[model samples]
Target: MRQEFTIWLTGLPSSGKSTLARLVEAKIRDRGFPVMVLDGDEVRTWLTLGLGFSRADREENIRRIAHLAMFQNRSGVATITAAISPYQRARDEARRAIGRFVEVHVSCPIEVCEQRDVKGLYKKARRGEIQGFTGVSDPYEAPLAPEVVVRTDRESKEECVARIMERVEELGYLPRGQVRCEVIVPADLVDELGTNGSSLLAVLASREARLGRAGGPVTAEEWEKIEQRLRALGYLR
Candidate 1:
């Protein structure tokens, strides 16, 4: 059976959470995995109507979505949730509810989000037309230690997607035998290391000899540590 997991994208409005979720959904489908996207706005219209913008209501909304994501995960399906999910306590509750959760923090400043607010919601919030709005009248508590953090303000859409994809692959959620190893190095280091740096080559060779006979790719955290060590050793700039 395929391994199942939930990818939760939480951030301020217009932070590119939905865009990244859609891109990830498409990539998962292309890789032959069953995936579902539970967008916040669409869910509010469908599953969470009659719920106001109060803190209690917001918690209930996230709870409902987390339950749904858990259901999909039980059926061997991956779920991508793009929600503002403004409270740390609410997000912690959701993570507890769904054991296999991967929190992806879609980080962008409120100023940028307001500028990208094509719906004029932010303008209204500023003028007191909208009350209890997240990142405006209300608060937006960001994730302290999410599985992945994508800064939409600084990164292109494609780069954001790539970062999420790398996390998904690291988590062993990709289809079996379809894992792709990506080595990220600085521009200056790329020329010196070429296609394979000595450190990376050694790591890959060792993993191939071990896991090739066993199974699975290296964990994302482990790869990150390896990269850090390489950087410290001057192998990566």
Candidate 2:
């Protein structure tokens, strides 16, 4: 059976945790890995609908999700959870419960999160319409030493996803000696591709498979560019 692990993404609302989780999940699934994403909002609606946003209720919510993640991990399924897990103690407990866990701190300033809030939750919190909202009326204890930290305010979604993938590789979650290659196209060239660039890579990978090549076809220039960026981002040695 494949190695199993859980990636817990903790951050404030609108901090891009869910978005990053989905991106990571897609990449892992594309590589033929068994993966699942436990989004906070969906879980709350389905599993913990009666639970309010009080500190105690939030702790219970996290515990429930952590137990579910642990169950999946024991079955050799990789689990990714995105939640505004406000308290550090609750997250620590989760890490203990889910033994092969990777804590990803999805960080962004409260101001930035408020600006990106499409649901108007932040505005409501600011006006005292909602109580115990993380990063607003309630406290948000940032992770002290998470395995990975992605700054959604400063980095692009692609970059954040790449960083997490690098961590997964380092932790040996991916197949042995198989490092996922992510091509970071320049912004000016992004429009030229006319697709998300994954489609292009998929085509190249398919051709390589037909040719029996060990690795996909990435030009020397492209490889160098990707390596340089990864090294600069401290993802590669």
Worst 10 residues of 1 by lDDT: 206-215
- Candidate 2: segments with Cα more than 4 A from true spot: 176-237
Q: For residue 163, give model 2's deviation from the true position in Å.
A: 0.6
What lDDT is obtained when candidate 2 is compared to the true structure?
0.75
RMSD of each: 18.9, 16.7
Q: Tell me the deviation in Å of residue 132 in model 2.
A: 0.6
- Per-model TM-score, in order, reads 0.73, 0.73
Per-residue accuracy of model 1 over 169-197 as CA lDDT, tens digit each: 78776644453333233354345345555
Give lDDT: candidate 2, residue 115.
91
lDDT, each prediction? 0.75, 0.75
